[model samples]
Target: MKVWFALILCWQLLAPAFANEAVPLADDPVVEQRLITIAEELRCLVCQNESLAGSRAELANDLRREVRSLITAGKSDAEIKEFLVSRYGDFVLYKPPVKPSTWLLWFGPLLLLLGAVWLLIRTIRQTQNNANTEVLDDTKRARAQALLQNTDLPK
Candidate 1:
Protein backbone atom coordinates (compact mmCIF):
# COMPACT_ATOMS: atom_id res chain seq x y z
CA MET A 1 0.00 0.00 0.00
CA LYS A 2 2.87 2.46 0.87
CA VAL A 3 4.64 1.66 -2.44
CA TRP A 4 1.41 2.30 -4.38
CA PHE A 5 0.95 5.62 -2.55
CA ALA A 6 4.57 6.60 -3.33
CA LEU A 7 4.06 5.76 -7.02
CA ILE A 8 0.90 7.91 -7.20
CA LEU A 9 2.70 10.83 -5.55
CA CYS A 10 5.61 10.55 -8.00
CA TRP A 11 3.24 10.46 -10.97
CA GLN A 12 1.34 13.53 -9.77
CA LEU A 13 4.58 15.45 -9.22
CA LEU A 14 5.88 14.66 -12.72
CA ALA A 15 2.57 15.18 -14.54
CA PRO A 16 3.12 18.89 -15.25
CA ALA A 17 6.62 18.25 -16.70
CA PHE A 18 5.13 15.85 -19.30
CA ALA A 19 2.18 18.19 -20.12
CA ASN A 20 2.34 20.32 -23.28
CA GLU A 21 2.44 24.04 -22.58
CA ALA A 22 1.15 26.92 -24.71
CA VAL A 23 3.93 28.46 -26.88
CA PRO A 24 4.29 32.13 -27.77
CA LEU A 25 2.21 33.34 -30.70
CA ALA A 26 5.29 34.47 -32.64
CA ASP A 27 9.10 34.22 -32.45
CA ASP A 28 9.57 37.88 -33.46
CA PRO A 29 8.85 40.49 -30.78
CA VAL A 30 7.87 43.10 -33.42
CA VAL A 31 5.33 40.76 -34.97
CA GLU A 32 3.84 39.94 -31.57
CA GLN A 33 3.66 43.64 -30.70
CA ARG A 34 1.89 44.45 -33.96
CA LEU A 35 -0.48 41.54 -33.41
CA ILE A 36 -1.36 42.88 -29.94
CA THR A 37 -1.97 46.39 -31.28
CA ILE A 38 -4.31 45.14 -33.98
CA ALA A 39 -5.98 42.63 -31.69
CA GLU A 40 -6.96 45.35 -29.16
CA GLU A 41 -9.04 47.01 -31.88
CA LEU A 42 -10.90 43.79 -32.67
CA ARG A 43 -13.70 42.19 -30.66
CA CYS A 44 -13.85 38.53 -29.72
CA LEU A 45 -16.92 37.16 -31.53
CA VAL A 46 -17.37 34.38 -28.98
CA CYS A 47 -17.04 36.71 -25.98
CA GLN A 48 -18.84 39.77 -27.30
CA ASN A 49 -17.76 42.16 -24.55
CA GLU A 50 -14.07 41.14 -24.59
CA SER A 51 -11.27 42.33 -26.91
CA LEU A 52 -9.52 39.68 -29.05
CA ALA A 53 -6.23 40.44 -27.27
CA GLY A 54 -7.78 39.46 -23.93
CA SER A 55 -10.00 36.52 -24.83
CA ARG A 56 -8.77 32.95 -24.20
CA ALA A 57 -11.46 31.35 -26.36
CA GLU A 58 -10.41 28.84 -29.05
CA LEU A 59 -11.86 31.06 -31.78
CA ALA A 60 -9.93 34.06 -30.42
CA ASN A 61 -6.71 32.04 -30.48
CA ASP A 62 -7.44 30.97 -34.07
CA LEU A 63 -8.09 34.58 -35.07
CA ARG A 64 -4.82 35.64 -33.44
CA ARG A 65 -2.94 32.98 -35.36
CA GLU A 66 -4.59 34.14 -38.58
CA VAL A 67 -3.65 37.75 -37.82
CA ARG A 68 -0.05 36.74 -37.03
CA SER A 69 0.24 34.94 -40.36
CA LEU A 70 -1.13 37.99 -42.16
CA ILE A 71 1.50 40.15 -40.45
CA THR A 72 4.26 37.69 -41.43
CA ALA A 73 3.03 37.80 -45.03
CA GLY A 74 3.84 41.56 -45.11
CA LYS A 75 0.32 42.89 -44.85
CA SER A 76 -0.20 46.38 -43.44
CA ASP A 77 -2.49 46.97 -40.44
CA ALA A 78 -5.16 48.50 -42.69
CA GLU A 79 -5.04 45.64 -45.17
CA ILE A 80 -5.31 43.01 -42.45
CA LYS A 81 -8.26 44.90 -40.90
CA GLU A 82 -9.93 45.21 -44.30
CA PHE A 83 -9.48 41.50 -44.92
CA LEU A 84 -11.07 40.63 -41.58
CA VAL A 85 -13.92 43.06 -42.20
CA SER A 86 -14.56 41.49 -45.60
CA ARG A 87 -14.66 38.03 -44.05
CA TYR A 88 -16.39 38.76 -40.72
CA GLY A 89 -18.26 42.01 -41.39
CA ASP A 90 -17.84 45.27 -39.42
CA PHE A 91 -19.01 43.49 -36.26
CA VAL A 92 -15.45 42.28 -35.73
CA LEU A 93 -14.26 45.87 -35.16
CA TYR A 94 -14.43 47.19 -31.62
CA LYS A 95 -16.01 50.42 -32.85
CA PRO A 96 -17.95 49.92 -36.04
CA PRO A 97 -18.31 53.00 -38.24
CA VAL A 98 -21.55 54.99 -38.13
CA LYS A 99 -23.66 53.95 -41.10
CA PRO A 100 -27.35 53.55 -41.92
CA SER A 101 -27.27 49.81 -41.25
CA THR A 102 -25.48 50.25 -37.89
CA TRP A 103 -27.54 53.22 -36.62
CA LEU A 104 -29.71 50.91 -34.55
CA LEU A 105 -26.68 49.19 -33.03
CA TRP A 106 -25.26 52.51 -31.80
CA PHE A 107 -28.49 54.29 -30.84
CA GLY A 108 -30.75 51.51 -29.61
CA PRO A 109 -29.73 51.85 -25.95
CA LEU A 110 -30.23 55.65 -25.93
CA LEU A 111 -33.67 55.31 -27.50
CA LEU A 112 -34.68 52.70 -24.92
CA LEU A 113 -33.44 54.93 -22.07
CA LEU A 114 -35.40 57.95 -23.36
CA GLY A 115 -38.53 55.79 -23.73
CA ALA A 116 -38.20 54.53 -20.12
CA VAL A 117 -37.79 58.07 -18.81
CA TRP A 118 -40.85 59.25 -20.74
CA LEU A 119 -42.88 56.32 -19.41
CA LEU A 120 -41.76 57.02 -15.81
CA ILE A 121 -42.66 60.67 -16.09
CA ARG A 122 -46.06 59.88 -17.58
CA THR A 123 -46.78 57.33 -14.83
CA ILE A 124 -45.81 59.77 -12.07
CA ARG A 125 -47.95 62.56 -13.58
CA GLN A 126 -50.91 60.22 -13.96
CA THR A 127 -50.63 59.09 -10.32
CA GLN A 128 -50.46 62.70 -9.10
CA ASN A 129 -53.48 63.68 -11.20
CA ASN A 130 -55.49 60.71 -9.93
CA ALA A 131 -54.69 61.53 -6.31
CA ASN A 132 -55.59 65.21 -6.77
CA THR A 133 -58.91 64.45 -8.53
CA GLU A 134 -60.14 62.00 -5.90
CA VAL A 135 -62.80 63.51 -3.48
CA LEU A 136 -64.15 61.91 -0.24
CA ASP A 137 -67.81 62.45 0.51
CA ASP A 138 -68.87 64.22 3.76
CA THR A 139 -70.42 61.05 5.17
CA LYS A 140 -67.25 58.95 4.63
CA ARG A 141 -65.08 61.70 6.06
CA ALA A 142 -67.29 61.87 9.22
CA ARG A 143 -67.16 58.07 9.64
CA ALA A 144 -63.38 58.06 9.30
CA GLN A 145 -63.06 60.83 11.92
CA ALA A 146 -65.31 58.91 14.35
CA LEU A 147 -63.35 55.67 13.84
CA LEU A 148 -60.06 57.47 14.43
CA GLN A 149 -61.37 59.02 17.66
CA ASN A 150 -62.67 55.68 18.99
CA THR A 151 -59.48 53.76 18.30
CA ASP A 152 -56.64 53.66 20.90
CA LEU A 153 -53.74 55.13 18.90
CA PRO A 154 -50.19 53.88 19.48
CA LYS A 155 -47.95 55.99 21.72
Candidate 2:
Protein backbone atom coordinates (compact mmCIF):
# COMPACT_ATOMS: atom_id res chain seq x y z
CA MET A 1 0.00 0.00 0.00
CA LYS A 2 2.82 2.44 0.82
CA VAL A 3 4.52 1.69 -2.52
CA TRP A 4 1.27 2.33 -4.39
CA PHE A 5 0.80 5.66 -2.61
CA ALA A 6 4.39 6.70 -3.41
CA LEU A 7 3.89 5.81 -7.07
CA ILE A 8 0.64 7.77 -7.27
CA LEU A 9 2.26 10.88 -5.71
CA CYS A 10 5.23 10.64 -8.06
CA TRP A 11 2.99 10.31 -11.11
CA GLN A 12 0.86 13.28 -10.04
CA LEU A 13 3.98 15.47 -9.67
CA LEU A 14 5.42 14.53 -13.07
CA ALA A 15 2.14 14.58 -15.03
CA PRO A 16 2.02 18.37 -15.32
CA ALA A 17 5.67 18.53 -16.42
CA PHE A 18 4.94 16.21 -19.34
CA ALA A 19 1.87 18.22 -20.27
CA ASN A 20 3.93 21.44 -20.53
CA GLU A 21 6.17 20.34 -23.39
CA ALA A 22 6.27 22.88 -26.28
CA VAL A 23 5.20 21.68 -29.70
CA PRO A 24 8.18 20.51 -31.76
CA LEU A 25 9.14 22.75 -34.67
CA ALA A 26 12.08 23.57 -36.93
CA ASP A 27 15.29 24.55 -35.13
CA ASP A 28 16.23 27.51 -37.37
CA PRO A 29 16.06 30.64 -35.19
CA VAL A 30 15.29 32.99 -38.11
CA VAL A 31 12.47 30.73 -39.36
CA GLU A 32 11.06 30.41 -35.86
CA GLN A 33 11.11 34.19 -35.37
CA ARG A 34 9.35 34.74 -38.70
CA LEU A 35 6.73 32.18 -37.80
CA ILE A 36 6.12 33.90 -34.46
CA THR A 37 5.80 37.32 -36.10
CA ILE A 38 3.33 36.08 -38.70
CA ALA A 39 1.35 34.16 -36.13
CA GLU A 40 1.01 37.27 -33.95
CA GLU A 41 -0.45 39.20 -36.91
CA LEU A 42 -2.99 36.53 -37.77
CA ARG A 43 -6.27 36.26 -35.95
CA CYS A 44 -7.39 32.85 -34.73
CA LEU A 45 -10.59 32.16 -36.64
CA VAL A 46 -11.87 29.77 -33.97
CA CYS A 47 -11.07 32.23 -31.20
CA GLN A 48 -12.06 35.56 -32.72
CA ASN A 49 -10.49 37.80 -30.09
CA GLU A 50 -7.15 35.97 -29.85
CA SER A 51 -4.18 36.05 -32.23
CA LEU A 52 -3.08 32.71 -33.71
CA ALA A 53 -0.04 32.75 -31.41
CA GLY A 54 -2.22 33.16 -28.31
CA SER A 55 -4.98 30.68 -29.11
CA ARG A 56 -4.92 26.97 -28.23
CA ALA A 57 -7.74 26.02 -30.57
CA GLU A 58 -7.13 23.19 -33.03
CA LEU A 59 -7.50 25.63 -35.93
CA ALA A 60 -4.88 27.94 -34.37
CA ASN A 61 -2.50 25.00 -34.02
CA ASP A 62 -3.07 24.05 -37.64
CA LEU A 63 -2.42 27.63 -38.74
CA ARG A 64 0.81 27.74 -36.70
CA ARG A 65 1.91 24.58 -38.45
CA GLU A 66 1.07 26.08 -41.82
CA VAL A 67 3.11 29.19 -41.00
CA ARG A 68 6.02 27.01 -39.92
CA SER A 69 5.78 25.03 -43.17
CA LEU A 70 5.74 28.23 -45.23
CA ILE A 71 8.77 29.51 -43.38
CA THR A 72 10.62 26.24 -43.97
CA ALA A 73 9.78 26.55 -47.68
CA GLY A 74 11.62 29.94 -47.65
CA LYS A 75 8.51 32.00 -48.41
CA SER A 76 8.73 35.69 -47.73
CA ASP A 77 6.57 37.02 -44.89
CA ALA A 78 4.43 38.98 -47.37
CA GLU A 79 3.96 35.87 -49.52
CA ILE A 80 2.95 33.81 -46.50
CA LYS A 81 0.45 36.48 -45.47
CA GLU A 82 -0.96 36.60 -48.99
CA PHE A 83 -1.42 32.85 -48.98
CA LEU A 84 -3.28 32.98 -45.66
CA VAL A 85 -5.39 35.93 -46.81
CA SER A 86 -6.32 34.10 -50.01
CA ARG A 87 -7.34 31.06 -48.02
CA TYR A 88 -9.14 32.74 -45.10
CA GLY A 89 -10.18 36.21 -46.29
CA ASP A 90 -9.28 39.56 -44.71
CA PHE A 91 -10.66 38.53 -41.31
CA VAL A 92 -7.53 36.44 -40.77
CA LEU A 93 -5.40 39.59 -40.64
CA TYR A 94 -5.31 41.47 -37.34
CA LYS A 95 -4.90 44.81 -39.18
CA PRO A 96 -6.50 44.22 -42.53
CA PRO A 97 -5.92 46.65 -45.36
CA VAL A 98 -8.38 49.54 -45.55
CA LYS A 99 -10.09 48.74 -48.83
CA PRO A 100 -13.54 48.86 -50.40
CA SER A 101 -14.26 45.32 -49.23
CA THR A 102 -13.48 46.10 -45.58
CA TRP A 103 -14.90 49.65 -45.40
CA LEU A 104 -17.90 48.52 -43.39
CA LEU A 105 -15.81 46.43 -41.03
CA TRP A 106 -13.58 49.42 -40.31
CA PHE A 107 -16.16 52.23 -40.24
CA GLY A 108 -19.49 50.67 -39.32
CA PRO A 109 -19.11 51.36 -35.61
CA LEU A 110 -18.29 55.05 -36.20
CA LEU A 111 -21.33 55.43 -38.49
CA LEU A 112 -23.57 53.82 -35.88
CA LEU A 113 -22.19 56.08 -33.15
CA LEU A 114 -22.85 59.20 -35.26
CA GLY A 115 -26.37 58.03 -36.04
CA ALA A 116 -27.05 57.50 -32.33
CA VAL A 117 -25.81 61.03 -31.55
CA TRP A 118 -28.05 62.48 -34.27
CA LEU A 119 -31.07 60.62 -32.96
CA LEU A 120 -30.40 61.82 -29.41
CA ILE A 121 -30.11 65.45 -30.57
CA ARG A 122 -33.33 65.20 -32.56
CA THR A 123 -35.17 63.67 -29.63
CA ILE A 124 -34.00 66.38 -27.25
CA ARG A 125 -35.01 69.15 -29.69
CA GLN A 126 -38.45 67.62 -30.22
CA THR A 127 -38.95 67.30 -26.44
CA GLN A 128 -37.95 70.91 -25.94
CA ASN A 129 -40.33 72.07 -28.69
CA ASN A 130 -43.20 70.08 -27.13
CA ALA A 131 -42.50 71.58 -23.69
CA ASN A 132 -42.44 75.11 -25.12
CA THR A 133 -45.71 74.53 -26.98
CA GLU A 134 -47.49 73.56 -23.77
CA VAL A 135 -47.38 77.16 -22.38
CA LEU A 136 -50.90 78.28 -21.39
CA ASP A 137 -52.70 81.21 -23.11
CA ASP A 138 -54.66 83.67 -20.94
CA THR A 139 -58.02 81.94 -21.60
CA LYS A 140 -56.58 78.45 -20.86
CA ARG A 141 -54.93 79.81 -17.72
CA ALA A 142 -58.32 81.17 -16.44
CA ARG A 143 -59.99 77.85 -17.33
CA ALA A 144 -57.34 75.90 -15.37
CA GLN A 145 -57.83 78.22 -12.34
CA ALA A 146 -61.62 77.73 -12.48
CA LEU A 147 -61.20 73.96 -12.68
CA LEU A 148 -58.91 73.97 -9.69
CA GLN A 149 -61.34 76.15 -7.71
CA ASN A 150 -64.25 73.82 -8.60
CA THR A 151 -62.27 70.73 -7.53
CA ASP A 152 -61.59 72.38 -4.14
CA LEU A 153 -65.37 72.85 -3.42
CA PRO A 154 -67.09 70.14 -1.32
CA LYS A 155 -68.60 67.47 -3.58
* Best-matching candidate per lDDT: 1
Scored by lDDT, model 2 comes in at 0.90
Give all TM-scores, in the order shown: 0.78, 0.75
Question: Cα lDDT of model 1 overall?
Answer: 0.93
Task: Candidate 2: list runs displaced more than 4 Å.
Answer: 1-21, 137-155
Query: What would the per-residue lDDT of candidate 2 be over residues 59-148, giving only the tens digit for each residue?
Result: 888889989998899899999999999999999999999999999989999999999999999999999999988989787787788788
TM-score of 1: 0.78
Candidate 1 wrongly placed segments (more than 4 Å) = 1-20, 143-155
RMSD of 1: 4.3
Candidate 1 positional error at 128, Å: 0.9
- Model 2 poorest 10 in a row by lDDT: 146-155
**Please, what is the whole-model Cα lDDT of each candidate in the order they appear?**
0.93, 0.90
RMSD list, candidates in order: 4.3, 5.5
| Cα displacement (Å) at residue 138, model 1 | 0.9
